[model samples]
Target: MNNHSRRRFLSDVGKGMLVAGIGSNLAMELGISNALANDDANALTFGSLEPLVDLMQQIPVEKLQPALVHEIQRGTELKTLVAAGALANARHFAGHDYVGFHTMMALMPAWRIAEELPQTEQPLPVLKVLYRNTARIQEAGGDERLHTAEPAKLADTRRGGERLLKDMYKGDMQSAERTFAALSQGERSNAYNDLQHLVQDAPDVHRVTLAWRAWDTLQLLGYEHAHTLLRQSVRYCVEREQERLKKDRPEPALRKLTPRLLDDYKLLSKKTGLRKTDDAWVEQLAQTFFAATREQAAEAAAEALAEGFAPEDIGEAMSLAANLLILHDPGRPEKWASPEKPKDSVHGASVGVHASDSANSWRNIARVTNQRNLVCSLLVGAWHTAGQTGYITDSPFAFDVDVITSKKLDADALLAELNTAVQAKNQSKAMAVVKSWEIAGNPAKPIFDCLRRYAVSEDGALHAEKYFRTVTEEFTTTRPEFRWRHLIGLARVSASEYGWPAPGRDQARDLLET
Candidate 1:
């Protein structure tokens, strides 16, 4: 391409005209049609994402790894590869399918893992997730049809998030998409904050995590494609609501409970308190949430907020309540551990994983949303977490660490012990080790290093990577008083998911090498 044509191509990309699903004819008109390299080049690809999206959709599962390896060797950006994966995922699943959206939830974390890894090993997470994405795409018959299209503009600009959520509640997909598309063009936070209102209306882990991940991948995909990325959340909400209506299931009690708690506590109009609490206070709050009914838990959180507790404190207590689910989980029943879903144990798709992921997502949502939504999200989280307590095991995991013989072990020794416990799948010992390390006032890095190894390599039934990311993030953002609880939560999960290797690590390593 000459300088003039290069300038034209870049200019078109700047104007967002290189959108793949809708711009093939436009590419031909611009005489840069070769960029759409594959014969089946139709999906919502954009700018640098075009050819990779084409390859991901059209390449056979057996052949895609080498093709991706070729793309990377030829100077393709990892962000672009991840961007294409997101677009491919959005095009194919659009947050509608179960496995489909789980794949979507893992995309950003895969990129994060790749970013932090050694250069030679960097491609493992990306390749593994892409392999999963394409395999699912092929299973759905290798179609190029998009579940999400270019959204139409809302005719009335006066409509906003509340109206958009109302549209979803009514199961109106077109109006929801249009409202969200127009909203996406405005301040990005406002659009995301609006979406949290709907996301917290249900206790579904996939809904909350998908909403957070869709907004998160924007760091790679950029806000120019915000409409494309965010519309998935809108569509997800609509589909879930539609499914609920189809089954004649009653609306989630949170729909009414959240607002009632918000108004009753005057939380919508008030700024949250900056009050901090001690460990005893946190333990008391967590136990209250653990044992209370959903309505009672929401009221407790609202009461705490009204009486001037910091939002993060309330979120911390809520996270602990969710962690309690993991701590008390009954091991997977033998009948449920079949070859088809072999990882159907307490570490993966259990109620604990669901609760933990949902609470982690709620914490993330709380950070970005408005004060009103923050309050509502916390209340809803408290309610949602309280609901999960019904699944707690008959015998809760022991909290007292009898195995730790020394009180002053250095960080490395503590980590080595913790790692031993994790490898052995000794949940009690792992929990005790981390708790002892925390009590010794050691730095967190060694513990992080210890857990990250398992998180990187373990299958975790697909939850390990995302859950690791979740705890790492939540630990950083949470208050110092309450953060170690997240690490303990991580140890519990890591120990539970210790033995199984990730699905394609060896294959990804070989493909990257040769």
Candidate 2:
């Protein structure tokens, strides 16, 4: 074809009809007549001819037409999705309902596709996932798909997953309709309850796809939900990758296990791995994966993997996701440190966490439902620790590097310096003293030592025993140089009247007490 003729497929006058809702590449392959190409649906184009099209085109064209709907994410559906998203955002500001925030955010994007961006719509793959798990709605002898299930039942089962439980209790008489209904509802759950339900048990191809969409949707609603979801994905991908490894390794190690299911599973897993990460290699390979366009993020992720940074790259990928969450919520650190601010910033003798809420000590920031952020942090932290330690044969936890600085860093006198800084409300000096040990290449032990000698007793105004223990762990596990920065970040949020290096100035003396 001449360049001019070939270009006709793109020219305004020669614009070809794009069969959008359904991804049928067969129509493109059978040499779709140039006559019909410019005749119908607007000049839209399918991103690529996905293999799923092979199954799609097999159905009679008449039936395929009914299957496809030129669905637009406008009108009543648009209002509902936007309204629900707004409501979820409001609930999040209340400070106690993170899960509720995520839930309301997850199930709305099916109705809110963005304009002028080539974002992969989540609804289609979600449909493919449903098709794989549910009983065939296509008839045996005929082509018509008359199996229309109840929309309300499907919606209810998905929102709470209550229907799945009810169906299971029926012992021998489970309803096939209900089973399909339950599978259909699975999209909204985020597998928040059971990680495997999405990563392993659910259709393999859709796991990350589902996560990214929900992650994208929540952020669009202007709530800081992606970081939590990113943390969850790190765990999900690790576990799923581990399972894939075990299932695919050739022979012998199978011990008492079967090989048939294992082999097919390997093949299926490989196909899934290819599809999920393929786009990541081609386009925006480096634009800060999460914040960039979808194609860009995928390409960046692929480039990272190709550069021999697998497994760890996932953590690095997670780092991008974490940045998005943190950047979105400037006050999150302070909120995490002490969620409930005092009525008027008044200090009762000492500015500190209320003794009444003391029973909930340490405020274990690791949410039970999603510990991915904590786990991912530990992973990065260890990597940071080893690099600082010089990666020797007999690996010591802390490095021996003597970071150069203008000021003298006397380790033995750190406590006195810390006290001096805190008393003067000098955030910079106080933070520097606390961080000096880290700069000296052995922070964990010294930080712990400082806490042991000066931290007030069990019920002290500020509990450095517990807080210091966590910081010690962070020092030992995270990037050596950055560990102190994390503390500084924390202090930034938890600042008291005396200033932030030590929030609750009155109680600040408790931590520095000799």
lDDT per residue (tens digit) for residues 138-230 in model 1: 788745435334445666544466777788788988778767767777788788877776787776788888988888898999888777777
TM-score of each: 0.85, 0.29
Can you tell me which runs of candidate 2 are displaced by over 4 Å? Answer: 1-299, 302-308, 316-409, 419-425, 448-475, 479-484, 487-514
Best by lDDT: 1
Please report how far candidate 1 places residue 117 from its true position, in Å: 3.0
Position 184, candidate 1: lDDT: 74
Query: How well does candidate 1 match the true structure, expressed as C-alpha RMSD?
Result: 6.0
